[model samples]
Every structure is written in C-alpha cells, then in structure tokens.
Target: MSVALEVKNTYEDFILEKDILYFRVGEHGLVSFHGKNYHIKKRLNTEEIQKMTSDSSFFKVNTDCYVNTRKIQHIGDGKVYFEVRGSESKYTTITKLRQHRLKEIVLQQKGEA
Candidate 1:
C-alpha cells in the first residue's frame, strides 16, 4: 500500500513544511542550484547529511543539499542521480546516505517509522 507523509517544523520564526519526494540515484555526486551554485562554500558528506536528515530540525532533499524539506518544490531522478526542486533551483540531487535517510524520513512522516 502507498502512504502519504508530511514533515513540518518551525525554526527561528521560519515555518518549514516538506512533502515526501521519491527518486533513485545510481552513484553519489554533488549538485548545485542555478543561482546558489557559486555560493556553495562547502559540501557535506553523506554521513553528515544523513545525521542532519534525522534531526527533525533539518530537511533532506538531495545528497548534495539538505533543505528543510519545507523548501522543496519537487523530487525527480535521472539515470545517474536524483534531483529535488526548491523555490529557485529546478533540481537538486541528494547523496547515497541521504537517499536512505529520506526514505526513513518519509516513513516517519507517514507515522510508519
């Protein structure tokens, strides 16, 4: 059976909400948004991003980026990687670890975790 899940949280006067997005990636890689690509100061590894994903305080969209899910627009996957859409970026791909964590988060959001 298919279940639907929603993630919601409030931080520093900002309200974040995330809907479940599904996709599959073959190997892990980095992704940058259209405008923010230049400002990527540092990239978080899969393990670190995974931890962030479970915090309930952060949102995990793709391997390369962890948005508050509240900021997600959509999720898609190509032959090599998965992409997540935000307010500006057309797509963002996540890492392998975050991929697994995303599944767990979705399940948790559905109350199945």
Candidate 2:
C-alpha cells in the first residue's frame, strides 16, 4: 500500500504521498496533486507537514512550501517546476539558501541507481 497524508480536503478526501506535488501555506494549508490544489481544513501547519513527510519524497523547499522532489521537473530562475499531466505546468520558488540542498537531494537520487 502507498503511504498517504492524513489531511482531508473538500475534494477527493485525502492525498496520496506519491501523487503529491507540493504543499503551501494558505488560509490554512494547500496541497497540490495531479494538477489540482486542495485546501486543508485541519489546523495543521507547514512545519507539521514537513515532519510527517521527512526522509520521504517530500522536502521543505522554503518557509511555507514543501515539495515532492520526485515530482520536480526542473529548477531554474529561483523556481522549481513540475508537470501537471493534463493541466498547465506549475512552479514554486526556492530560496537562495536552500537551492544547493535541493540540488544535492535531486542529484543523490539520480545516483542511487
């Protein structure tokens, strides 16, 4: 079985770990998956989400956004991009300080084979 986040939204109910593209802070919290965004109703914050997805595919890219490195298409111009199947592409910013770390993580994954 695939691991999934317990946060519930008004749509499909829950988000699967592998399908998550990223999570960002909003009125509450927002989780992006498969080209769609889900508003988190629970009181959980970005920090809490980070802890739950740690050592997994998810990496906290900045203060309020956590990205699934496996879903990343490319990183450039201070932005991290992802392909959204049938929808338009999406991107989120990566902090200058954290860019190196993100690169290391992506490169490390590539070398694992």
Candidate 1 residue-wise lDDT, 1-113, digit = tens: 99878653222222222332222222352322222222222244778445545656355454434444433334334211224433434444566556566556645655742
Best candidate (score: lDDT) = 2
lDDT of 2: 0.68
Alpha-carbon lDDT, every model = 0.40, 0.68
lDDT for residue 9 in candidate 2, whole number 0-100: 47
lDDT of 2 by residue, 1-113 (tens): 99988775435655446556677644555544333443343446678755655747778788767788887878777888886443456778899888888988988888895
Task: Estimate the TM-score of every prediction.
Answer: 0.32, 0.64
lDDT of 2 at 39: 37
Measured on C-alpha atoms, candidate 1 has an lDDT of: 0.40
Off by over 4 Å in 1: 1-55, 60-64, 70-90
